[model samples]
Target: MLELRPGCECCDRDLPPDSADARICTFECTFCVDCVDNVLRGVCPNCGGNFAPRPIRPASKLTNNPPSQKRTFNPDCFPASR
Candidate 1:
């Protein structure tokens, strides 16, 4: 089951479960679309791989398999400016 995180790890942006701007790596490391594209340059800071938009989990399944509400914010993972 995908653990739907609540916020962007980089900029601390709010990323609700249904947020279109939410991007995640294979490891489910979540980030905002802007942070992923502009700041991280599409490179996942934790996974070192490309990111894709997070799939929205259906509400029906949410009751049975609840998404994670835990926030795993990583503030020091931004790309270094040249």
Candidate 2:
């Protein structure tokens, strides 16, 4: 099961369970679209893998399979200027 992490690991942006902005690597290292497109340049800082849009869990299923409350913030993952 996907952790459906609650926020972008790079920018700490809020990415709710259903947010289309969420992108994740094969390892499920989550980030926002902005960070993936601009800052990280389609690369995952943690795993050095390409990112794909995270699948949104259905609202009905969310009740049974809750999204993770953990927020992984790695401000140093990329340069701020990028």
Give the TM-scores of the predictions, in the order they appear.
Answer: 0.88, 0.95
At residue 34, what lDDT does model 1 achieve? 92
Model 2 TM-score relative to the real fold: 0.95
Error of 2 at 60 (Å): 0.3
Model 2 C-alpha lDDT per residue in residues 1-82, reported as the tens digit of each score: 9999999998899999999999999999999999999899999999899999999899999989999998899989887565
Error of 1 at 31 (Å): 0.4
Model 2: colliding residue pairs? none
Best by lDDT: 2
Model 1 worst lDDT window (10 residues)? 73-82
Best candidate (score: TM-score): 2
36: Cα error in model 2, Å: 0.3
